[model samples]
Target: MQFKHPEILYALFLLVIPIIVHLFQLRKFQKESFTNVAFLKQITLQTRKSSQIKKWLTLLTRMLLLACLIFAFAQPYTASKNQFNTQPETVIYLDNSYSMEAKGEKGPLLKRAIQELIENLDPEAPISVVTNTTSFSNTNLKSIQNELLQLPYAPNALPFEAALLKSEKLFSNKPNSPKNLVFISDFQEQQKPFSKPLDTSYTLHAVKLKPQVESNVSVDSVAVTGKELGKLKLRVFLKATGPTAGTVPVSVYNNQTLLAKATIDFSETNVTTFTLTENHIPNGKIVIEDAGLPFDNVLYFSLNKPEKTKVLHIHHQDNLDVSYIERLFNNPEFEFSTTFLNNLNYSVIENQQLLILNELTTIPSSLINAIQSFIKRGGYVLMIPNSLANLQTYNAFLEPYNMVMQAGITSEKRVSKISYAHPLYKNVFEKQETNFQYPKVASYYPVKANTSSVALAFEDGKPFLVTQNQLALFTSPLNKTNSNFSEYDLIVPTFYNIAQQSLKTARLYFTIGEENSFDVPVAMQADGVLTLHYNEQTTIPLQQYFNNKVTITTTDIPDVAGFYQVQDKQNPISTVSYNYARAESKLSYQNLENLEQVQVSSAINTAFDTIKSDTKINALWKWFVIFALVFTCIEMLILKYFK
Candidate 1:
């Protein structure tokens, strides 16, 4: 047992006052005469024994009360044997992640945690404090208390296992002392489990904070539908974390103007599609009002005006499929042009988004080289076969890309199946019909190539339409003389989708803290440098330029999730959007069962008690105060009734 204020114990000498008063009262009393000798003698005999017993008991209680009061005022406590020899080395892992913004009993969970830490920590002991992004080592509690109070919520989070390992490393070379690690966090369930067994040398403590509310809703992702020219549609994916079911108000905005608003019943559906009639919106966002966790309630997205896709059709002079090809590429979204293989311009090949070879008898050496260079620079090509063409020239042209044209033409095949899930067919149809008509080809060459996917296959298990990287090939010509493919309903969509997929545009959205890279089609010429703009601020990101293509990488420009634009000086080249990570939207937490080798406490005060218990220092001041009051009450009762 130890007294906090041991010098105050000198007041124990005041116990002499009670002893002196008892001694004075015990001095020789004057003899009193009794009215009757027999009655006086009996009264004297009975009263004397009872009076002596009551007086001694009263004196003992008074002396014990004085001692208890003194002990209570001195603030006595018992310390473990090890505690007296050295101070404990404590490391506190405080979770400052955005999830810690949850409200607790007193205030924000983080504020309450800081208050509890300040009140319970040993002032004299040197401590270490670690947050998600920063740490301070070998500092006293008083020195870092202000910094703790001012610590802001961090955008990133650290797992419990990593924090524990960091704490272990911090104490590796420290002087020998009783070691302790206290982890104060909400213990979100997304944290990965410990990979290996923990070191047993240091004692571990956990303080888990509980959120005031249990329900949360978040925007999971956004996807664009249909690349048409008029109105654009966005599909927003939302998820509810708890069992609550109700209507949530969702709104879409372009820049600062409100475009559309709707209320969705999340109990029935998790996806909502919104269409914006306003064309050419460079920046936009969708917001939902959710008070439980507002960080993930808003999703940002960007849209570029549909650019005209430049298509170059290279074909033979007598090709019969030119009319069908022209009709497919005549939409307002495409810049369609045609040229014979003999008169093809190599300079124009670099400017085209797609190239179509319509039943050509032979591929020129220079044309094949230009086609290879075009595909390498993110261009698409579609080829149609000529049954009686020069197979040697075609195979020689394709051999460098691991592709070949077989010599024989088969006349007994029809397209048996279609890969409806391929990106080439995305958003082409509302729904796939089971009994759709299949296109039949009278004659086609069996292709031999290492292709990425077979878009359409023949009944004999041969590929009808095969795609190798950026190149798409057909085994049969589209002319009416060889097959009915030119007249089939599938030909229109097949050619239209290829033209649509060739346009280069920014991605729909990116997640914050994830690496983002964009490929701009504009060349870096003269003194032109790429700059990104968010709100009113401008920043230049890391950029590399080659062959009229500028690749930009953003390192530290965006600190928050929102819509941003990349430009060369004043010309806006592309727009992109960023959204916060959705991992924290999952409010599931870890219980004691999830953490195996650590002591856990839900309350901060309880955690302090656990630490004290580990050191064998049990506080006795409260017990002494209670005992002092009880003894005083007993002495008063004896004095009042016994008299």
Candidate 2:
């Protein structure tokens, strides 16, 4: 038991005053003679003894009554040890990710958690609430009640470790303060295992909100699986959790018009395909009817009108085997052209997206300056060194990229290693092919390269092809006498993707909360800026202006998933789509009960109750008040009834 105002306890010393008054009676008694003194003397002795006992009883009761009143005024209470001296600090981590849209016993998990927090939390206690995208620090529940009620779901979920770190940072630095870190989420299983933090300054409590049913299906992804003359066959990937069966209806919409509708037989398959006309859907949406999670029920994608990438090849007039360059860029997606070094039109260099210097013996200083400026303006360049190329001239052009041309190596080396994870081959191959026919080069120049820059290596681990930002270099020329690389199957994707990436056009779609960059081909004034528009919402994305295009990079601005129009003020350039990632669609969760130094519960209110119990105060002052009243009644009975 502890006293709130212990200074009132000094009044206990006043009990000595009552004892003094009882022992030394201040009232004087008169002695008088009366008849029958002998019998009267015996009766007086009995009366005096009984009266003395009564006075002692009354004094004991009165002293206890005064002590009880003093204790009651002191406001004494019983509570957990050290709770009276420790200050409590609480921080709550609320997971507002899309997976929280799952239904619990009450309602949506996020919504129910919010309601419980508002209902159970101390209205005036200082607390901090950490969400995925926002934080309400050092605030009371009454102040952030409205904000918690309207909190929206985030596209990205904060990692469990990150959330723990964030919660700890919000706590006060005062030592020995009782800190409670409450984590309220569904405890979804992530790609990596949760590393438990070892900090002992705070107590960790986890409330795992489980859904009523574990069965849920989600639209995983949409991709063009096949293509024909004027139609594109798209496949929709679906993912299910637990035991889900039966056919689900899927619909494809272009703007407000329905393009096609189909049903996927879940009992037999997890995929369905739909064929639509080419160049028809500038803004496309694929939706599935599911009663599970709502965020992944629909997928958004954009297929804008195609733009041909410009390719220009500069070669020496003496070289006659330019068949490989011509055949690779012969598709309808690229506008391929060639020119001799003597006939190089410097005026057209700025318009081309990719420039291939095929077998150039000497790079003129004037042409080198033009190519350098072109590359600096977001253009790509591929350098194929001639067999007898002048090293001094080539080294001057390669000096800025931390590369140089070395003397030729007269050895036959086969191209055996491919950096399968390079951006050039991101999705080019389904798996790493180890048994493909290796292409051999009879004689080649040896150029040093950074370990990360080597996209393809020779059998001796020398760089056969190295690529830096906006530049790709081959150690040797591809002429039939020097190498047979032009005849192999590896040359198509290598050269084709270079031209394709140079344009930076819109992809099928992009995921939100990721670093997404693309180019908008529009000439803007020096002060002009680009903005994204989606249903009356406009946001200016981070953009870098170039000669004929603007490179736009977005991470967290356009948070909603939908088709956004890339606009220069009001004029539209193109359309791009953003969609939430499908990571939380499967509904797998982690079991946190076995974690060390953490208390696990299944409800938000229960977790709060545990925290409340830690600092709960059981006031003994009311019981003391009742004791004071009883002592007063006992003293009155002794004074009135005992005599």
Candidate 3:
């Protein structure tokens, strides 16, 4: 028995004082008065035993009162059994994420959670088991127990919140019954919360998931390129998510035949590349047979033949700086062209995959509007600041779409901290053969602020390389007045990454960090069917959105699959020529740290009915009060009869 207020029992010590008073209440048997009455005085002493008996009776009453008072204060209660049950209906949310695959003392977490539910089930109680799989639904113990044995691992993802909400809604339908929720999962913090369940309404039983101690290696991402029908070049990101680093050999195969192979020097960002020599090989899986983690071992992609996306650069002026950009960007994918702003027509924004804003601070209002429209419609714009740059005017062009560049300078010393996470650094330098500093910008103008912009490069701890919300506007600080402007290393990768992003030929096969939404332009109507021809044979119809300019978002392109060519049959003008720009080359990888945030819902609170029990354990305290009442009535009757 547990006492809610056991300390109050100290008051029982007062019983001693009452006992003393009761003893004193016994009168001397009136022996002297009896002597005055001239007889029976001898018998007075004989009645002394009666006096002692009355004193003892008074003591017994005091003891009873003290016992009653102590019992009231201590408030002892028995642990409730069956809770005077209203037949509880419980919703058990099972955390079935990849992390749940970790083994537990009982068994695999999935089976253990199920077993725990079965053991905890009161025969009178009803329960629903949810695995958080896409097929999650409410099912009774008899109906789902057999199904649990055949539960297949879900491939999509752990949707913690969605599962919880579904549980809550199912429990809500049953009223008056006691509701309770039991959850089993790794309880990753990255998971989002579902409907907030009230504490009074349900009991929360949280089952902790076992920790992950084993090393893991996963494929963080993969990219494919070349415009040909089947000849595919693949770059895969192999991350050794384990505590220590190691190397692994990743091979690329077309069907069962080994096409190309590369030994990846492993790190957190373990990367390897291989080329499928022959073009027109549409479908195949590139497998990393020896990575520690199996989830990322193999990636599936459809390869296209040799193809490159074109980028036309329009510079404000043709000078040494502009010539360097033109030469660095001279490749099959990029058909480089440039003219003075005055010589170029306004419609150039419409024709080019990307436009370079070099040394042009003051843009024509029409050009600014065109650029803004292009940006909203998902066009790529790379802005390089110059000595005579107008920060206010440039910001005006980027302001609407969540971007601004303000820190002005002729130059300040800076260097690109190669973010291997960035596609630019992914496969470029695999193993560090030499301590190549690449190139350093002696001076730069960092973006004064960022809203939708992510600081890709830093200058004196300020953002020098910034990407806009959609990643469409890539701004860099190229203080043209700085002596470093003529260097090749400093300018090449910047143009390469930004230009590649614009061409849309480089298919990003993974989603890690947040990416901005950029325009996917095809001359098509809002409702037109845009086909993505991965190779010569496979064509996938892409969904479109009708905004100011017919634009499409790129968030849906996370999968590694065949090439695509968008086609709008209704509007013949809306057609995009399919091409592959994937550069197949293998390189060692950088060790990228895992994100600390848990990306799945914890499903902490389950849903159940609120059944109020008619009898509570608190009723035990009432027993002592009732005993006092009955004793008081008896004492009153006895006193009246005796008097």
Candidate 4:
């Protein structure tokens, strides 16, 4: 019904000249009378009415022919009803993360999406696919869809908005108009806020995956192994959601050996803390009871023994804050060291894993250079400023990295608005059955942030918790000059977060969960070992390394704040792991209300589902042209031969 170029319709004006010429059309009737006139008069009298009607019909046919020619030149045809042209360049934002595997029809959410995709395809139309990739790639539609169909469903999730924008850019080569985009997913509430805007030029189809409410018992979280030697402590938490299942069975393993078994209840949140009697398990794994949701039933992880952390504490000449902070890392497993502003040994700051700059009234530029280099090489710094800490030195040290501290602001209003989103917050409540909320941002420093900086804590209305690149920083306005330290609860979690973030380095990092056997770059001899000691007794060997990493069963390593030693033992070369936490609480599904209204049903009829076959296309439009030709031909031969 639409025209590709409707403007050609003006060609109808060409018919005016033909009509004018016809008006002037005349024939000189030879006045041959007599006998022939008598016979002609009798014949003309009998057929005069029929002949007049034929003349008008012939004129109308000529006008129709002119109109048909003009219309054909205009290139008129049907446009796509999918908010764009029928031959749209489309990108399908397919949600294939682990979370997409939630049970639906016959299997999971992803299966339904696949089925719907097959049914809804605008036969032969271009379509690209996108999933949960850590970094996006630019690729065309067909190949992307093939890759998606090959991947299995999972429980992992990705940001909704990010994936859409990525898909848009990939299909940008198509004409600006008549583009197509489809988001096939379960519009979970968290994902709803990030939904993309509708594009009329690009037909948007939300092939939503239907959600059904189901109870989920997930391993909400687990805490660091142990703080001291022989403690070998751990806290494993279980969260019961939806309909309670009373008690669930849980088992754990070390390598292939079954270590412990227990029953977990669902009436409330459950926290199970147990110790590892064996000092060297090498690798560890945990298997929870299968509760229909198979993706989270068994968790395989690894751990490392405790190791010493070489710490550098910076302070003013007469400041006593250094001593108290220094006392926390005094255990032999930790080599506690100190320096005062312009006087300390520079080499200590370079080699140490932990750097603590205290109530320094002034900081020399030399330390600033050391701090910058240290962070660049995977060093962790903890800034606990007393009122006396030098604002100028702190600002200068953080300027290049885009973190700044404003001078001389002090108040203890209480820890008001806490940032529960940070890992620091998670670690503090890891052992509690119920998630513990931070009391309040007591009288403390207000933290600020830049683009790369993420707030990990807060006080008043400012950010007290922060991370830049991978470096972690916490600010406190306590006891600066007043010598009155407040908000002591922050001490443990702050240190815990520092240790965890500092020691984070992936054995191998991949954007997608579907991949296996990632390549490791650091060559390990056939039997050489790269060891990571958590405190004293526990040690983790880097089984392999390449491309700046190796394959590590994340849970097998100890996530404590310390220096890791990668030793080939025979050749004895060393490497280390900077802090990064593997588990994120954000993965926990909070909505008990199942997403049940999504269109994961049997294939429904839609404009996109039509397939083009010569038989079918010819049956309609071709018939129109055929009938038009047949009628026109009859009219033409009748006029030509009879006349």
What's the CA RMSD of model 1 in angstroms?
Answer: 11.4
Q: How many backbone clashes does candidate 2 have?
A: 0
- Candidate 1 lDDT over 1-643, as tens digits, reads 8876889899989999888898787565455886678877887778878888898999999889889988988888786544654677778889988778777778778888998988988776688988987898989888888898899876667776677777677665535578888888998886475322455677778888999787888878877765555777877888888865498888888888999888879778878888878766667888898876767888888777555778999988663657888888878778899998778778999888899988888888888889889888778899887877788878876786677778767576778778888767776667875686677888888778765588888877788888877788898877787777777788888888777656544677777666667567675775779888887989788876645556677644576788788888899877888777788788888766566667788988897787777788667879988998899899889988885
Residue 389 shift from truth in candidate 1, angstroms:
5.4
What does the lDDT read for residue 20 in candidate 4? 80
Candidate 4 Cα RMSD after full superposition onto the native fold (Å) = 9.5
TM accuracy, model 4: 0.59
User: How much is the lDDT of residue 338 in candidate 2?
Assistant: 96
lDDT per residue, candidate 4, 473-555, as tens digits?
55664343442333355565666556545544333111222332211224444554455554464465334432223444334
Better of 3 and 4 by TM-score: 4
lDDT of predicted model 3: 0.53
Over the full model, what C-alpha lDDT does candidate 4 score relative to the true structure?
A: 0.54
lDDT of 2 by residue, 196-219 (tens): 588558888989999998778888
Could you tell me how far off, in angstroms, the CA of residue 332 lies in candidate 4 after the best superposition? Answer: 5.4
Q: Give per-residue lDDT, candidate 1, residue 591.
A: 66
lDDT of 2: 0.88
Top candidate on TM-score is 2
Better of 1 and 3 by TM-score: 1
Q: Kindly give the stretch of ten consecutive residues in candidate 1 with the minimal lDDT sum.
A: 190-199
RMSD for each model, in Å, please?
11.4, 4.0, 10.8, 9.5
